[model samples]
Target: MRSPTLARRERHDLCDLALVLGEDAPTLCGEWTAKELVAHLLVREHSPLGALGIAVETFARLTDRAMARLGRRDFAVLVEQLREPGLTPYALWPVEVLGNTLEYLVHHEDLRRAQTDWQPRENTPADDDAIWTAIRIGGRALVRPAGVPVRIRRADTGKEVTLRGGAEPVTIIGSPTEVTLFLFGRRQLHDVTFEGPTEKVAALRRAALGF
Candidate 1:
């Protein structure tokens, strides 16, 4: 779950992402402008709490509009809108708070990858729990085919988890942020140190997304 403080911090981090995108700058998500990112977030903030399909449709409409008229100045306004209390639930996830945390941290990294000084500082324990849950939910299996085993360790908490079976054992060690990105198809394996058999990692990389 997200603490109130962490939720607020993530909101701010997302707002900063929009602010830095400049008036017409494009984002890493397709051709979405930073303003479009803000618009999408705002729409998500206001989306229905029930019915996932309904939420998806609503988000698509909002994204379409945002893409047509996104601008830096508009993004600035959206940032201010986010600063207000109770703008929406502000809870990052619908199923589990940990899921939300993982989403925020990973997306924050996505935005930061494009900026020189956009790093968002995360509270260690929350991020740790989020990463652990993300892996257990079968996120690690996303890179490879079924039946690949993966051993992951959280550097901050020194907690080690192993997802085993189906081919070979693949080992990965690093911060939660690093592991999350790797599972989500963002960061490269080179940024992460891999041990165990090469075939294991290769097979794991070819597996489908578990969760």
Candidate 2:
């Protein structure tokens, strides 16, 4: 819920942390190195431009070409280029601004999940509200519940948002960053704490699977 400027600063904080964490850390996403996650972010940052259809087509073609040519040794250089100033314009509309931010914020949380040494600036109530709404929008592409309600509560502030009216509610309680990582599918359910019906929660978890 930080200001756009503050949010960008937060992103930089994570960038520095990733550099320190090294590419070989055990990330929540399979065995991906922190560097690889940043590479994926770079790809997403440059892929969105013009209309959704055009943007998608262009991104696919560009990514294929880039992946073929860039290779692992050159990935960091490419990522540095894409993360340069004013690169946000290349992202698709809506996604360019909001989705990109959401993407980074969630992954940054994922990269920092287990470490107690790092702490993201706490999100204010207003910031939390904005992120809550933004995630609900982006999460649609990610989560499709089969009529099961899921409620998320933030640790920084005692704020709760509920997606209801399905089978039963599967509530997850944790810090906002942890919740974000879980919802983004970077972290496993084993890393999360859940309450309510186990079967229903499992079904909802299956529906909420992340990439």
Candidate 3:
């Protein structure tokens, strides 16, 4: 089984931070407090149909209702539930690795980058590789909808991957971890830069990126 070590680490760390900052602490998830964010995670894993609603627009109301119902539980209990991979299909090793590594990492940052005093967190080489792999796997799907070609570059190794194909692609430059966060929709909070045609760059920037 591929190691889901990064997913596990981020899960633990995110839960700890959620508790330390208390339920009302703000997060980068568009006005979701730490409490609401924790509830969302809980619903995503525990409720299969609810998780489906997350990506399928038609089922969004269902997801919203599930989150609202779970959000009423004690915040600490919600966090504890998320501290583990849980009993759902998400707990399967391969699924956990491919699906959750970036999910937890990005959500972790949603809590972190929202703080008044925040800085880019450091990552290990293994974690970097995992995040880069995850980007290669899921990043394209997130960016392709923008209709502009997109490429992402790792600032450290300079490794590049085409997220979308076109005449000219917007190249996003950052560490893999930051790039992962950027592509996942945390725009202003990440330390990444863009390069490409000015008009194309502006359009992509103005477009809501990430899933």
RMSD of candidates 1 onward, in order: 4.9, 5.0, 1.7
lDDT of each: 0.57, 0.58, 0.86
TM-score of 1: 0.67
Which sections of candidate 1 miss by over 4 Å?
1-3, 23-26, 48-73, 83-96, 116-147, 156-158, 163-167, 188-191, 206-211
TM-score of each: 0.67, 0.67, 0.94
lDDT for 183 (candidate 1) = 72
- Candidate 3, residue 140: how far the Cα is off, in Å: 0.6
Q: Mind sharing the TM-score for model 3?
A: 0.94
User: Model 1, residue 109: displacement in angstroms?
Assistant: 1.3
Best by lDDT: 3
- Pitting candidate 1 against candidate 2, the one with the higher lDDT is 2
Predicted model with the maximum TM-score? 3
lDDT of 2 by residue, 1-211 (tens): 5335434544675677676776565455555567656655565555443123223664565554444343465544644554543545633345445645566677667677645454544676666665666665555444554356777766556566675544567777775555666677654323357788988778766764543
User: Between 1 and 3, whose lDDT is larger?
Assistant: 3
Q: What is the alpha-carbon lDDT for the whole of candidate 3?
A: 0.86
